[model samples]
Target: MHFSLFLGPGVRGPHEDRPAIDLMIEQAVAADAAGFTAVYVGEQHFNNYEPYADGLTMAAFLAGRLPNAYLGTSVVPLVLHHPLFLVERANLLDQLTGGRFILGMSGGRPREGKTWHKHDLTPEQRSRLFDQKLDVMLRAWAHRAGDQPLEFTTDDEYGVMEGRMMPASYRRPHPLFAIGTNTPAKIAEAGRKGQKVHLGPFDPAGAGRIAALYRDSMVEGGHPAELIEDNLRWLIHTKIILVGETDDEAWDVAERLFTGPMVMAPWIRRDPGQDGWSLRKIYRADPGPFAPAMGVPESQGAFLHRTAIVGSPETVAAELAGYRDAGLPHVHARFIFGTLDDPEVFRRSFRLFTDEVMPRLGVETIPGPAGDQVQIF
Candidate 1:
């Protein structure tokens, strides 16, 4: 399966003596050398879960640094930005990356709205807004003089004036548009549009439902049966850390590193009433039973395994094999999670995965621009 790396600058740690930007660059450099296919950055604001307020900027920096790797946003909160401005930023990044940019759009989370004290929109409203913004962006990218006109007016001395975005996107028809959400309708929409879907750690049954929904929607949308096979790219995001000699050793290291101070500080912690519920509760409350006991009993491990690709290279490989069998082609490994402070350990795990697991799976290691390979200690 194709491997992608997900970078969370804020979640990596607080902005201390070493700026997060530098660490981000270092991670990109390492990931590129490790021969990963793509690197995705998430858009998080006000909170420390991810420090990068603007994913487009970080993506541009990565694009410049790692020429061989594809750069993408895990999901941009489209509802937060004006469609025209967002489209412009996307086009610029697309050009900067030389057509290696993938646009991942989402309706955003309810907590994010609360952060800005913005009105909490209903799911339907958010979806509608998402659709409108997407439409505007698509049109702007495909803009020509006679095609259509997008008009915007501001309160001033003068009346309204017509306007249209200039300098369309470099990619013909537009850069890749992938929908990032767990909603069935969104997944179906991606299938109908022949775009990719981002799947995270969910129960195997849930995964099957997502896949089936996408496939069914593809057919219902009048897409050819094989369209799903041709263009359907499943981007699975999972917490993964490669272990060394024994699974036990890996578990010990993971628990210590993940639960450390730098990694799970106030920023990463969930605040009541502010950070909504669901995932925040999971993070706020115990990381769950399996998480506390690093050993991870089979039943609990099975549950976690559904969402995270952890353990030794062999173990991770076996799990990945199942995903491959289930029609997932792309896997986005989130190397940073919880509160892991030691970069060296992270590097080691990543290196081991590259050296051991990927090769056995018949996945070729394509170096990023720097052509650096990871060496396990």
Candidate 2:
């Protein structure tokens, strides 16, 4: 099983501010040393909230620093990028990482279009655009100099032309492809193409259902049953906060991190009775008291117990085992979320997991300490 870490560039806010790119470099070094198999950086733009605007760029930087660790994007919003350019960037990063790169693509959120003054595309449009972009990217990666032309159409006009993408990916036929979505149709589409699917929001029950759905769809779509067993990789991303000695301590840390100014800078407005609101709505809401308070200590404690891998290493390992039993092939830990900015806290939790949890699961550590600098393999 692969153990991955999901790191955001940085959240917005003066008090919750992170150091600089240098800090990210340090964090990558730490992750590599702590024995993480891979690292995924999420992409965000416009808002000072998320420092990393280009996941490909960050992946390249980390690849240079940690040659042994796989680098990937949690999900790039393909609708916001020109397909050809996105492909080029992906290809270059894959080459730089010596094939240890996975590309995850997503349709941009409707609110993002409004932020950029672009027309808000419908779900069908986004789906079609995602399909087309994938086709172009795959074609660019697969074609050879004398092979078939890379062709695509935009606005009903077709164009055909291309040499192979420069800095061709080290992986044959390009690096792995992953689609991130909560919908069954999207998950089925990915399975039909033999692509990996990332499951989310820390819901194990939902993840199990989605994984089963993908496998079932793969068989229904004429893929061999063995194909599902061989090619499918299940990645679950979850929020986590580990406490050293007491549950209260863990709750305290979670509240501070989640409520930190940087994380909540663009506060999310929650309905009085609803659990939470989406980030898009949060960004659009006025900064009034109506903006929901961060999860209380007790509520947070319940959340951690329910959705996160927290507590001592033994406890965390047990929780992880439950996920494995549920059929997760990879688990992506969101160690840094909201305000959890203390380097010491991050390193300690990472160390505990690597030293105790990972070995118990019989997975090999990627090799290194928590913050050692790396070079691309």
Candidate 3:
């Protein structure tokens, strides 16, 4: 199994003045030096949750710094940009990264309202537009594979290509494609099309079923055996990870690291008008007077137990072994997130995991540590 680093947005308190981008750079550089397989970044806008506003831009910048590891977007919102522009940028990254780029995409952030979109597109409209855009992008790339370039039209955009797409991708056809989805239909369709699916932090027990659905559907859809094997080899899942000298120490630190600022930032700022409002409201219920009024501590505890892998090196290895045994081929470790202020703590835990735990996984990793090799500008 491959272990990669995922850089998500974090909360910076009022007194914390360091740029979030710097932290992202630090994490990516460290991952590269540590011999990680890949580094993925998240895209966020308007909200201060994510470190960067654009995933591709961050990936491009980090690609230069991370020569040893593959770079990809955890997911770029496909519906927000022109398909043609996205194709150009993705192809550029493919060339620049020496074909070590994966374009992970998603439908736009429907929860953020339409403020960032050019028009007020409903969720259904956005989903349809996403499909149309993907179709156009793939068709354009198909020209490189000897397919005739034909005229294409989306809801508000149309274009015709007379020849091969400009600055052809480094990889034939295009860079590897991935999408983050929980819907079985979407997962199966991605399998049919030979793209990867990111099963984000879902329950491990269900992951086997999802993985089976993907591979079984791929076989049923008549995709080649090599394609199915490669997809299975790179099938992605996410887990929040923290390691310590002992399991108890890890959980204690997790309660401190993920409890107050970590959980509250997103919960308080989330779109109340969107789905799961009532469920979130219960977690944010009134603690009454004379109590620490905030998101429920027990809720975060339960969340850590289910979603995060907080334990000693031995424990972490065992938990991850279960994932590998369950047929997950990739694990994206989220070492940084909201309100985790101490970079040194992150570094220590990351080093411990790399030095002690990864060896037991029996997966290939770059040798040696890259301490202080991180560059900043």
Question: Against the true structure, whose lDDT is highest?
Answer: 3
Tens digits of per-residue lDDT for model 1 on 1-377?
A: 77888886334445432555566677778777777777888787766665667788888777788867778888888777777777778777777776667788887867788765445678787788777777666666656656545543311111221354544565665666677877676778777777777755554455656677777778877877555664555455444445565665666675565454324323232335534343312323434332221222323233444445556788778878776666665677766555445666766777788789888787643332221211111
Candidate 1 lDDT: 0.63
lDDT of 3 by residue, 235-334 (tens): 7788878899897777667656765343433334333343443332332453222112223233432344335787799989998988888888688888
Query: Candidate 2 on 124-156: residue-level lDDT in tens?
Result: 877887777777777776677777777787532
- Which stretch of 10 consecutive residues in model 2 shows the poorest summed lDDT? 289-298
Alpha carbon lDDT at 277, candidate 1: 40
Give the TM-scores of the predictions, in the order they appear. Answer: 0.79, 0.79, 0.82
Q: Could you tell me the TM-score of candidate 2?
A: 0.79
Highest TM-score: give the candidate number.
3
Error of 2 at 343 (Å): 3.0
Candidate 3 segments whose C-alpha is farther than 4 A from its true place: 13-19, 117-123, 144-149, 161-164, 260-302, 365-377
Off by over 4 Å in 2: 14-20, 115-119, 155-158, 222-227, 241-243, 261-307, 364-377
Which residue pairs show collisions in model 1?
10-51, 201-307, 263-339
Q: How high is the CA lDDT of each candidate model?
A: 0.63, 0.63, 0.71
Model 1 RMSD vs true structure: 8.6
